[model samples]
Target: MDSGGTPEQVLMGGSMLIGTVGAYLVLGAYLVQLQHYCLAGAEGKRKNRLTLYILVGVVTVCETLRVCFITFAAWRVLVLGIGQPVLRQSPAKTAPSLHILGSFIALFIQGFFAWRIWTHKFNKILGAIAVLIGLLTTTQLIVGVLTGVQLGRIGAIAEQAAVTAGRNGVFNQFINNNQNPGGLTPFAISVGILTSTVFVCDVLITIGMFSIFHVYRKRSMAPRAKSALRVLSINTLENGLITSLCAALTLILYYARVHPWIHMAS
Candidate 1:
């Protein structure tokens, strides 16, 4: 791949193309979902009106920004770098990074679930565990943002990062770690922590939901309410499992290094 994120790296063009198309596809689906939600008239006066608006606003903005950055990156590589000279350059070149934005949105959504876990009636032990899960999500956000900042210091011309070359350069130290625990760089350490938190947070949240179900099951609720809880528990399991699996797969593919494009596609 082009270390500078220039178009000279035709070898990884397929990866960038695939990623760009995937971004647009996902964006379309997201927008459609948002439209449906809006049409549902949930905006009609409600107790949590402000909270709902904020949730929608934050996700829309973050998702839009992610797609824009990725699109710009693809265009830069495929169009601008087409006939450009491939002079040897510093290994630590800068470019727009997407993971930080992803981290922010995931943290926001998962935080909502964490808040649900906290607010719902439960034992003190479970309440304490919910708080712990919330803290872990916050920690993930902080680490993700810090990693983006660190990467920006060493990568790109137009978007985010800038080049800083050397054996000890930020980029080299980052990519060199290879996920080794003993010699991990700050970036790798943060990534490892970030992915771990994602998996653990989702799992804990799902378990909390099940606990909530168990608590509600013992109550004398209406049949519809009980039915809703059952469906919710199933939904939670599916969502949590898919999220955790993706994070694990991405981490694995990243460390495998079989093909640079493979990890990017993940």
Candidate 2:
């Protein structure tokens, strides 16, 4: 590969692209379904349909933003300077910040939807868990941005020290041992934690969705309401699973630690 990636590295990169695209397709389909439901004008269900549309629309935007960042990173890695990591530069470096911001926006939307659903007869514990997850996601967003900025500052300090020390200082030692062209830094540990938190939130949301489904199956909600809940439950479950898988894949890629493939590409 032009990026000095091995064939296997190329394959893994390709897989990530395909998987991300597939996720966008699923999200897009659900958004369309939500719009249809919103516009169906089913008498008393207008509010519910509108709420669902809003929730789906926010999630769709988040997913779209994520895809854009991923595409930019991929392009940086594959087509730009062969040995330079794509994420080391200005716009590429901003991608994660954008993702974190988008996640916070999505978290707010998810929380609002969860709150609306909490008045029903479903498991209160599940709803509480979902709400807590949303809160945690918001925290992660804030922490992620702080950590990224801190890491960037550290990189700048290291670069300056490398210049002045002529290769014999603490900062130079840190740079030699810790710095990567990809801009991976110790602060990225926080990002890993944030990603894990997102996965946990997705799992909690899925649990809440299933709890609602179980309650609906046994209870006496209106026929149309029950049908709408079922659609939401199914879509939520699918989205949660996909989100969790993506988080796991990202962590794996981030922490693989050795750039055997990065070097091969270079």
Candidate 3:
């Protein structure tokens, strides 16, 4: 199996690409909302303006942190020649923070979806299920973040050992010690759990929201309204499918040993 490049380069380079694309998408969504507001006028905008701004702000803040961490990690690796251990350690520390923030944003977005569903159907049970699932994912992410912090602490210890044993020796030691309690297996398991939970939450939210939209489309009598609803339903489903696929792939990569890169990229 040819892996192509050093994992450090693969991870950092992949993150750079993801972050750039994410920034564009985040800003683009905001821009689209703004453009719609401009064309549709204040009354149409008033209903959604606050929510759109909140989405933009939350995504912007999360992406800012992501870019900052990726930039520093890249500088440390490529420019400073910090080696594999530092690359692994540095990103491991920051990745969970990003994961937590991303999960928080997901919760907010999913909750909004639940609220919308409830607003349409007035179904407390459905909304409660959506919110409950969102909370479940958030809790899992919090635990995963804590586990990652512990992993980072372990990495820091390994880093100290590396300083004494020299750069190349670090990998050798990790390979030997990875079965120990404070080693690679635990971190991988945590990541797997985290990503899986995220995937589940996304899938549930997608189903819930799409179901609501489907009902709305079926119930509408006016052709124009039905057509507009169809467009929205398609967009919602498309976006959810993309996000759910990413989450699924991220878990697959975690188990496959791609680790931090795939998670960051997603």
Candidate 4:
């Protein structure tokens, strides 16, 4: 190899470097947000204040662990295993587990939103929708954790045996391993659900926010109040829009018969 190394090495190395930097940047931003939240404290005498605090704490722990995992992966790929071809073929344990951790993070955050929606006043239809969306997010979280356990199993249970016996399994309905590369294993199906579930949940949250705020906007007489509602509605969508779009794109790519590894970009 030349002094620059092969093309694949350069690409992989550059990706690892950029990912590590981005992960730290995100961690820093999250810290700032957490600090701000603590300073602000509880907003009102809301009944779910305790639940909200617990959710925030869980999310903070998951975010920290996620960054630690990424740092460890960067260390493995760029420092410990630098220039080794095995890096190309062997997956890092931290890498796969990151998705599971991410699912936890998403689950907690959405749970917060769901709690908000439930606490806020809403019509029956919107309330029902929010409840259903919340249930879906919970189900997805369960599936994600189960899939992680399935992958990390340490017994004599063969993959084929477990999978074959899993026709009625909750997530197995999505896994159709009839063929080779195209066939969706439990892991692939779980990932696909994760992406789609994220997109669906975000969209529903945004819509619910809009619906809740629209009622207030319609009843308000003051122009300033209406304007504030307008801004808040836009902000609500903005908060979750990017996340939804990214999840949607990942889902598209995963189902498009493209390289399945593309989801790791999300």
Best by TM-score: 1
Per-model TM against the reference: 0.73, 0.63, 0.71, 0.70
Q: Which residue ranges in model 4 land beyond 4 Å of their true spot?
A: 1-50, 150-186, 221-228, 255-259, 262-266
Candidate 3 per-residue C-alpha lDDT over 21-89 given as tens digits, one digit per residue, 9 for 90 to 100: 654565566567557745756546367777766775776577567656655544554445434434543
lDDT tens digits by residue: candidate 4, 165-244: 43222221222223222232555677777877888898988888878888889989999999989988887777668657
State each model's C-alpha RMSD to the native.
5.5, 6.3, 4.8, 7.2
Q: How many backbone clashes does candidate 4 have?
A: 0
lDDT of each: 0.62, 0.55, 0.60, 0.64
For every model in order, what is the number of clashing pairs?
Answer: 10, 4, 0, 0
- Candidate ranking under lDDT, highest first, comes to 4, 1, 3, 2
Task: List the candidate 2 regions with Cα displacement exceeding 4 Å.
Answer: 3-44, 48-66, 83-93, 121-124, 151-185, 221-235, 252-266
Worst 10 residues of 3 by lDDT: 168-177
TM-score of 2: 0.63
What does the lDDT read for residue 72 in candidate 4?
A: 76
Candidate 3: what lDDT? 0.60
| Per-residue lDDT of candidate 2, residues 174-211 (tens digit) | 22245434344543456567667766766776777677
Model 2 CA lDDT for position 104? 61
Candidate 4 lands at a TM-score of: 0.70
